[model samples]
Target: MNANVLRYSAFTTDPAGGNPAGVVLDARGMPEADMQRIAAEVGYSETAFLLPREDGTFEVRYFSPLAEVPFCGHATIAATVAHAEANGAGEKVLHTRAGRVRVQVDEQFTATLTSVEPRMAPLDPDDLDRLLAVLRWHRDELDPALAPAVAYAGAWHPIIAVSTRDRLARLDYDFDALSGLMAQRGWTTLNLIWRADADTFHARNPFPPGGVVEDPATGAAAAALGAYLAHNEALPADRVFRVHQGDDLGRPSRIGVTVPEDPREGIRVSGTAVRITDAANQAG
Candidate 1:
């Protein structure tokens, strides 16, 4: 019944920074309930459970403290890096609840995940109203350029682009109300973002359903965002975009997003991971 639980924080070299996740190297023999309990005990935003297949690919499941998620970006990054550190860096295929994900780990401890095909849909007017109310934000605060929409890579996230960085910095939400709305809409997080420049953005994610108030570095949301930008032709194709998150939470993380010309290849979300020490683990 024992499983190897490796702790790694993705999106930053410093263990104290970025988003921390637990990786279960061998979840083959474990039951669903066992995986849930382990994830709850680990108490990170998410933990990845891997069951290797005969073809060298693996079935990957992600569980948060409260429930299972179809996919999780930070956990994928952390788990892939942890796997590479132990098994050598190379391409790995993961069969997630969302779909197939291809990850490449380099020698430098950086892992990049190619998301499933991404898409965006218009947000329901009433749902958007409720979300804005819960966040205590006015319609005028939203950026007119980036309209409200539900974007999906592996999971669905509602993209709410704020007009100013200050609006994004002040993140206060009605947890119960937002959680209720998210549960109803099958949303993983509310991607709150502010466009600082063409290539740089400031963002925050409210994941009340996952039992986390906010995520420091959200790889799923980043992929969705990249898709949104590319789909709308918002940014120059040759440019690299940066997403800065966790600064408000003090864990400050940076996510690098690259959008190639081929839209079907999915966006590239790259980040580094660091091992957490005992003291840091205790504190978290």
Candidate 2:
């Protein structure tokens, strides 16, 4: 095993409750192929590689077991927390393929990533129709008040708002179909959401493009959703909310997002991460 390779679960205090990510803090000399191979060997949904810069910044890259992705939220959170634990908590700038992301970690090991400027686009009616069929959802299942759209906050995701928690719980989907559509549209994940209240939401993400059925905690998607809701005036003036995800997968996770008054600015996604012990991996 690579000594530099560390395992951490993001978005939860318990190592077994959040999204597992392999974090390589000193991957400066590693080749792209080696990083990919290591990510595959780690067998997590995603792994983060950090190449330190002379200016104290980092050139970060994310990879799944099957392919490389532009940005990954869970991996970023995990990596920052791991770094803070080893080197002391502070701020770090990550230069990702998508954009530059600013992250800060406090002494408590809570990490927050501020996404790039968020943008929203309309989800084509034709695509929405097809997506619903693949996901076994009907038009009536959608929340009429919460409009669906494609939002980008470091990464692109289709923000879908369902009407009921029951509708969101049944997550069976046509993996191949959804993955193909997302690939063609260049989306990272399908942010399937159900608004729980004025300040709470339930979400599930389909990440077949990364060879994973679902992402337990997706901070990028949460950030995007915050922007989406804020721009549409759908959220409260406070623009703070908590998202519950991964319950159906038995690895429950929570993500907190704060949307600023300026919609074009970055959104803040905060969560806790814990180092995963080998014993926990063996138990799973």
- Return the TM-score for each candidate structure: 0.96, 0.96
Model 2, which residues run further than 4 Å from truth?
Answer: 1-3, 279-284
lDDT tens digits by residue: candidate 2, 195-252:
8889999999999999899998898899989989987889875889999999989899
How does candidate 1 fare on TM-score? Answer: 0.96
Question: On a 0 to 100 scale, what is the lDDT of residue 190 in model 1?
Answer: 93
Cα-based RMSD of the predictions, in order? 2.0, 2.3
Candidate 1 stretches with Cα past 4 Å from truth are 279-284
Q: Give lDDT: candidate 1, residue 180.
A: 91
Write out the backbone clash pairs for model 1: none
Candidate 2 clashes between residue pairs 3 or more apart in a chain or in different chains: none
What is the lDDT, from 0 to 100, of the residue 179 in candidate 2?
92
